[model samples]
Target: MNAAPADQIRLLDVQAFDVRLQQLAHRRKSLPEHTEIQSLTKDLTQMRDLLVAAQTEESDCAREQTKAEQDVDQVRTRAARDQQRLDSGAVTSPKDLAGLQHEITSLAKRQGDLEDVVLEVMERRESAQERVAELTERVSSVQAKADDAVARRDAACEELDGEAASVAKEREVVAGVVPADLIALYDKLRAQQGGIGAAKLYQRTCQGCRQELAITELAEIRSAAPDTVVRCENCRRILVRTSESGL
Candidate 1:
C-alpha cells in the first residue's frame, strides 16, 4: 500500500496521538491512588470487622452488667427484709430469734457477693466500651483515608479522561485526512505490532525496532519512489522517510 509523502507524515501525527492516548490510559490505570485505595480498602475491611466485634462485646457486656446489678439489688432487698424481721419482736421464741439473726447474716453475705459480681461486671463493661471506642476511631480514620484516596483517584481519572478525549478527537481529525487503505493497513499493523504501526527512519535506523537498515535495505529505500510506502525489514513497520533519514 502506498500513500503520499505528506499523508505518511500525517500518519506519524496519528501515531503520536495514539501513543499519547495509550500513555494517558496507562497513567490512569497505574495511578498511585489506585494502589493506595486498594490497600486502604483492605485495611478498612479489617477495621470494620474489628469494630463490629468490639461493638458486639460491648453490647454483651452491657447486658451482663445489667443482669449482675439486678442480682445485687435482689439480694440486697432480701437482706433488708430479713434484718427488719430480726430487729422487730416478730420472732418471740429465743430459738426462732437466733435462727432469724443467722438467716439475716447469711443474706448479708450473699448480698455482698452479688455486689462484688456487679462491680466485676461493671469493670468488664467499661473495658469493652473503651475497646469499642478505640475501634470506632480506627474505623473512622481508615474510612477517611479510603474516601480521600477514592476522591484522588476519581480526580485523576477525570483529568486523564479529559485529556484522552481531546487527544482522541484530534487523532480522529488527523486520521480523517489519511487514505482509507493506508489507515486500514496502519491499524492492522498497529494491532499486530505493539501499538506502533509506523515509525520514522532517522539517520539510517528504523525507529520502531531501533535497528540500522543494512546497506542493501538503505539502497532500496533510497531508490523507492517518494510516495512509495516502505516497511522496515527489521520491524516490518512502515518506515516514513524524512530529510534526516541518512539514505
Candidate 2:
C-alpha cells in the first residue's frame, strides 16, 4: 500500500507506542501483588476451614460436658433417695439394707467418674476455643493483606490505563495522517505477528526479525518511490527506515 514518507516515518512512533503499551499491560497482569494476593487468599481459605473444624469440636465438647453434668446430677439424686430410705428405717432386712448401701456407693463412684469426664471435656473445649481464636486472627490478618494487595494492584492498573489512554489518543492522531490502505495492511500484519507490524530498518538489518538484508534489496528499498511502503523480506513487517537506522 502507498503511504507518504512522513506517514511511513510516523509508523516507527506507532510501533514504539504499541510495544510500550503491550509491555505495560503485561506488567499490570503479572504484578507481584497479584500473585501475592492469590497466595494470601488461599491461606485465608485454609485458615477458615481450620477455624470451622475447631468450632465444631468445641461445640461437641460443650454438648458432652452438659450431658456429663446431667448424669452426675441424676446419680446424686438417686443417692439422696437411698440415704433418705436408710434414715427412715424403711429397709428392715439386713441384706436389703446392705444392698441399699452398696447401691449408694456405686452411685457415688459413677458420679465421680462423670465429673472427671466433664472436667476433661471442659479442658478440651478450652483448647478448641483457643485454636479457633488463633485461626480467626490469622484469617483476619491474611484478609487485610489481601485487601492491601488488591488495592495496590488496582492503583497500578489505573496508572497504566491512564498512560495507555494518552498513548492511544496520540496514535489515533498519527493514524489519521496515514493512508487507509496502509493502516489496514499494518493492522493485518500486527494480528499475524504478535501485535508488532512495523519495525525500523537498521544498517541493512530488519529490526523486527534481526535479519540482515541483501545489498540489492537494501538499495531497491532505499531507492523506492516516495509513496511506496516497504516491507521486511524476512518478517513481512512494514519497514520504516530513518537516518539513525544507519540504513
Candidate 3:
C-alpha cells in the first residue's frame, strides 16, 4: 500500500529470506538422520526387552542347576552310608541283609537318575548363558548405532540452526526497510500460502505457480505504477518484477 519503487524491491528480499528460512526448517525436519534415529530408538527398545528376557531365563536355569546339584549330593551321601553298613557286615539276619541290599539297589538307581538330570540341567544352563551373551552383544550394538544416529541428527540440526540464524538476521535487516503495512500483508499471506507470500515475475511468468500471465494481465502489470504491489492472477502471490525478470 503506497510503497516506493525501491521499497517494493527491498520487500522482495524480505520475502526471499522468509522462503529460505522455511526451506531450511523443512529440511531440518525431513533429514534422513531424523528418521534413522527414530528407527534406531525402536530397535533399542526391542533389544532391551530381549536382553531382559534372556537374563531371566539364565537366572531360572541357574536355580534349576543348583537344586539338581543339591539332590545329587544328598543321594550320594545316602549311598555312601549304605555302602559303609554293608562293608561292616553288622546285619546277621538274612531278612535284614536282603532289605539292606534292596535299599542299596534302589538308592543306586535314584543316584543315576539324579546324575542324568543334573547333566541335563547343566547343558540347559550353558545354553541359557550363551543366549544371554548373544543378547548382551546385540543390545550393545543397537545402543552404539542409536548413539551414532543421535550424533548425526544433532549435527544436522546445528547446521540448520546456524543457517536459520543467519537468515533471520538478514530478514530483520530487510524488515526495517520495508513498510509496516507491506510486511503485515506479507506475513498474513505467508501464513496462508505455506510460508511463501511473494514470487519473482520472470518473462510474464508467476514463479509461484510457474504459469504464464495472460497478455492483458501482463500488460497491466508492466504498466502499473512501480509503487503499487501486484498479485499474480494464477497463484495470488505478490509479484515482484525486476530487470532480471525480462518484463
- Best candidate according to TM-score: 1
Runs of candidate 3 exceeding 4 Å displacement? 244-247
For each candidate in turn, the TM-score is: 0.95, 0.94, 0.91
| Model 2, span 129-171: residue lDDT tens | 9998998888889999999999998998899899988988888
When sorted by lDDT, best at the front, the candidate numbers are 1, 2, 3
Point out the worst 10-residue segment of candidate 2 by lDDT: 238-247
Candidate 1 vs candidate 3: which has greater TM-score? 1
Ranked candidates, highest TM-score first = 1, 2, 3
Model 1 segments more than 4 A misplaced: none
Q: Which 10 consecutive residues of model 3 have the lowest summed lDDT? A: 1-10
lDDT of 1 by residue, 41-106 (tens): 999899888888888888988898888888888878887887888777687898988888888888
lDDT of each: 0.91, 0.88, 0.86
